[model samples]
Target: MKLLERILKYQIVTSLCVLTLGAVLFYFSVDYLIDREVNKELMRSKAKVSWQLRHINELPVYILQLGDSLQLDQVRYPGQMALVERKLFNEFENEYQPYRQLIFYERVEGAWYRVTISKLLAQRQQLLEAVVMTVTFIVALLLISLLLLNSWLSRRLWRPFYKTLRALDSYQVEKHEVLTFPKQHTVEFEQLNQSVTHFTDRLAATYQNLKEFTENASHEIQTPLAVILSKIEGLFQDESLKESQLVALSEISEAANRLAKLNQALLLLTKIENRQFLAGTEPISLVPIINRKLRDLEDLIEQRGITVKTAIEPTGPVMHPALAEVLVNNLLTNAIRYNVNGGTIDIALNAGKLVVRNTGAPIHIDPELMFERFRKEGTHSASLGLGLALAKTICQVNGQTLTYETDGPWHILTVTW
Candidate 1:
């Protein structure tokens, strides 16, 4: 059976058992109470007869006539009248009361004298029947109420969860739409709805990003490889001039370099997107890291006449030193590559914030567009525009924020923890 039906059945069975036990106990109790009342009335009548016999000296003959009219039998003395017919007698007779036998023989002359008294058992069968009927009616009403209540409660409790399940079932990966869950009043259901919504959204985003990355990587890799193959074929066909062959060989080498860079970019993006950089965290002094990267790029920095400045704090225990290194290297490279002749690159790290500002001509391209892969802002072949994007991905994975803003003659790249 379904869950609701099973719950209803269990509840109904339990309620019925309780009601049945109560009815049985009520039936017995009612029977006992009625029997006691009836016995009291019968004993009262017997007491009146005993009282009349004790005051026999002042009794009239009409008292005997009265006893006949009342269907009561009398004996010679009070003790003799106690046990007349002895019907339905008690197993243990009362010790304080003495019994006497009185026979009600046929009437003689006008006297009509012989006597026998019979005690009747109390009428409890009708009382038991009434109690059963009353309790049955009450139980029926209670069962109806319980069923209605159970149904209402079940619907209210399961409504949100049902909606969540339906949403999940209808989710489409290709569509890439956000799944929304209904709000719930119950705490557990509300929490469940929130968790499901979060999980589905994350899954959809990851799937879409991976799909786009695959498509872009294929296109990027194929174009250059095709150009290189075509150039080599063309060079083989031209056997007339050595200079033409040399130029073709140079073109082929350049194409190969471009292809290699494309592959490396694709691999690096995949690694960042796949969260492969999250190994362990350690204390990394930003000053040393920046100085090392600058030293490595000293030739390029000097050739460009870019004056670099740094102010870093001695912070401990930053997240994922490898990722941090990648982020810093990418930002510094972008700043230096885009800087003007004799430009200035200011790098600062204090507390948990790091800012890399470069003095150059105002960036004509939108800063937002610069973070997209293969989107170069100007005629700079050295920049494939994947560096900033990679840095952004690393920051996102490590729970940091990277933002870009320009002030007057300087473009600022800020990373905050």
Candidate 2:
């Protein structure tokens, strides 16, 4: 989830909990306050009745009326004041109404008299309900407003972090381009940008040093390798060499050739890794490349008596031309080199994909390990085993996928983007 969404979720949940608890407390608080006001009114009525008893010297006629709101009764003993809630019947309304009742004793003319006062609470209850609803609505409106305002502010506050993320996504080490971070006011975001800039600087320095080293080492090794091959060729031409000596010389020659090939392959892989091909600047068609390579290998195919089938479609994909050649060459060579006598080589090309299938015995090694450098099956002593690995690296450099699978006696290699 996005950071803003998570923060808002937690805040909203906490606010809702507090509001629920506050609502319960609010209801009871209003109930108590309203009851206190009713009781005060009852005390005032009792005081007025006592004043009347002291002056008038007789029971008031108003107290004798049935259904009157107040009632007075003469008693022999003093009684304390008490308040209660009661359900009383109303003759006019013909229903039970809740009332707040107050009963107290007042001394008048040397005798104690009980006086009772009651007030209907049905109207007051309606008023309290309305007040509660209004308060709740106001609180809900405030909460909603708070959420919206907070969301907007959070998006604005986090804008710098998002900008930094986009920059990081687009950054590529091979490009060697200097990174420039936008100014950020927040301390943490500023620190993050600084750290990323420092890290990229270090990575670029390391890549430059590695590229230099690979090129220098490959060049230095090739010169001595050329000299060794020359001397080995001279030794092969000598007439006085014995049969046992000839075999050893041949083996030495073969080893030198293999070493030369390995050096070239490693250099090519390093170049691909360094993005030195510049294939991105131009578009290359695969149909012509495939046809030319096949033509070049026609003699080898005929020697093995292999049947070649092709279903080529016109495809124009932008990639390194030399790298593209290497990719196709490796795949075709692997297919031909491993095929049985009179085996079939099937090649297909379409938009954004290629598939090469060849008839061969099932590979003993796991198919998943086939792309690892120097991974070989059985006793293919002449094979260097870097072909598939180099091909996979080229595909990855061009933002493509390469996969291998075996079905029965047919080995399949697929390249797709």
Candidate 3:
């Protein structure tokens, strides 16, 4: 859940608990007050009835207050004075209702009589019921008002936060663009925006410096490497050089070429990992690239006596054309380099997928480990062990899956987009 939603949830739960508890307490409080008042009225009536009984001629018919009835019963002996409450049947309403009665013994004209003042509680019960409904209604209105107000406040108050989040979402480091924000009223949001601006500024500067350094270093290193290879070629053509010296020169030339290839491969891998190449919106078919690469490596395939099979479609994945060529080249070359003589190579390309399976010696360990740079299954002196690693890096940067598996003597490399 979003931060605003979580806050609102906690607020709603807290309000409900407090409102419910308050309502219960207030309801009981009101009921208690009403009961106290009813008891007071009954006591006042008891005093009046006592006076009337003492002077029997002053009042005789009825003396209870409104909604109350007075009753007197003659008895041989007075037992006790007490107050009691019970449910009584009302003749007018034809229903059972609550009543509070004050019972006391009195002596009148040399005879013992019990006096009872009974008060009807139907009105009090109605008042309490009304109170409960009113409290419930008020609480509901309060909750609804709180919810609406909280939602409005949360959106209004946290607007700056969401705005900052959106800015970060669309941020691209390759663009080297620094983030900027309007002034925020909230202190925390303003601080957060300022922090983000500073962070992006630092990141852009660092990326630019690194990119410049990589390009400059590669350019600088390539110049000397070219000179060394050119000099080694000159030494190869020297007529006076002995056979041993020529052999040594050939070895040096080969090592120099390998070093140059390694440098270029590492540079390409670094650039790909840095997202220097951005994929296009549309998927570019790999069939043409696959066919072209196969033609370029046809002579090698024919020399190795390896049979090649291809099942290709026009569909492909979204990627930069240059990176796509490198990816396919590495996969295909790696297959050929490791394949057994007179073996078969199967290539399948469909919508969103490409699979390359080459017959080779069975591998005992995991195929994924081969994706690591300089990790090779067996000693292939000509192999730099970087082909699979470079291909894996390209797929990762382009949001594709490159998986490897071995079945019997066939080594499979699958790329899924």
Candidate 4:
């Protein structure tokens, strides 16, 4: 959930709990006050009844019918005075209603009697209604205030934070730009802004230093490799050199050439990862590129006695044209390099995807492991093992997916956008 949503959820829950508790306490308090008033009225009625019983000769039964219930019962002895609350049946309403009773013993002309005075506790409903109204009013106010607070927070308080986030989202290390923000009133937001600015500043500096170092190292290493290869080539032309020495020199030349290629491949991989090549917005057609690569590699395919089949459409993914060429070349070469004699290579290109399935010796390990650079199937093989790694990197940087799967002798490499 969003941060504001989480906060709102907890606030509402706590407010409701508090409101419920307050309503409960308010209900009981109102009920208590109503009972107190009712009990007082019952006591007054008991006093009048006691006085009337003492003057029984002048008091008439009809005078006691003024809303209060009065009862008298002659007893052998006067018992203790008592007060109680109970629900009593009312004949007029044909239902039970709440009443408070005050009972006292009275002696009238030497005859003992018990007098009970009852009063209805009618304010209980009003207490309930009052509590309900108060709770509802509180709840309504809380809801309105919370909504207003949330709106104000989102628009005003969180504005600078979101702006800082947008700046960070589009940040690019290659641009070597340091991030700075306008002053913020909120301390936490200011701290966040400062931290982000510092982080981006450090990131840009580090990336620039690394880029320069990589360029310098690649240049420095390439000159020596070229010299070594050229010197070995010159030694090969010397007829005075022994056969064993020439063989050793040839091996050294091959190793040097492979090392140079590996270095270039690694540099290219690093550049792709560093976002040096950005893809175009529109997808470019792979038909022409695929046809061109096949034509160029026709001799290699024929030499290996490999049969090539293609089911292609004029469709491809959005990517840099140079990277597209490299991606296709690697997939095709990888298929050819690993194929058995007279093996079959199947190429299919559709609107959204490209599939290259080649018949090779069944690999015992997972096909996904081949994407790791320098991971080779054979220990003594001449292959540099960077081809699939480079292809995978290109697809990744260009927002495409490259997957490897195997079925018996057919190894499938798929790229999807």
Per-residue lDDT of 167-250 in model 3, one digit per residue for the tens?
999999999999999998888999999999999999999999999989998999899999999999888888999999998998
- Per-residue alpha-carbon lDDT of model 2 for 1-417, expressed as tens digits? 988889999989988888878887888888888878767766766666667777876656464223437777889997778888899998778999887778888777687888777777787789799979987997799889989998999999989888888888988888885567876889999999888888889888988899999999999999999999999899989999999999999999999999999999999998897887775665577899899999999999999999999998988456878888899999999999989989999999998889999999888878979999998876677789899999999999888899999999999999985
Assess candidate 1 and give its lDDT. 0.71
lDDT of 2 at 325: 89
Ranking by lDDT: 3, 2, 4, 1
**How far out, in Å, is residue 353 in model 1?**
0.8
Q: List per-prediction Cα lDDT, in the order shown.
A: 0.71, 0.86, 0.91, 0.85
Please state the error at residue 249 of candidate 1 in Å.
2.2
Estimate, for each residue in 1-417, the C-alpha lDDT of model 4 and write its tens digit: 977677777877787788778778887787778777776777766667767777763345554434558788889898889998889997766888877778898888888888887766555666668777887888779777976787677668788978997998888888898999998989999999999889999998889888888889899999999999889889899999998998899889888998999899988888888887765788899999999999999999999999999999999999999999999999998899899889999999998999999998888788899999888886535688899999999988788999999998899999999
Off by over 4 Å in 4: 40-67, 77-86, 89-95
Instruction: Flag regions of model 2 displaced more than 4 Å.
Output: 18-128, 279-283, 364-366
* Deviation of model 1 at 155, angstroms: 14
Candidate order by TM-score, decreasing, is 4, 3, 2, 1
Q: Give the TM-score comparing model 1 with the true structure, all chains together.
A: 0.47
* Top lDDT prediction, candidate number: 3
TM-score, cand. 4 vs. native = 0.89
Model 3: lDDT of residue 203: 97
Q: Which candidate achieves the best TM-score against the true structure?
A: 4
Candidate with the larger TM-score of 1 and 4 = 4
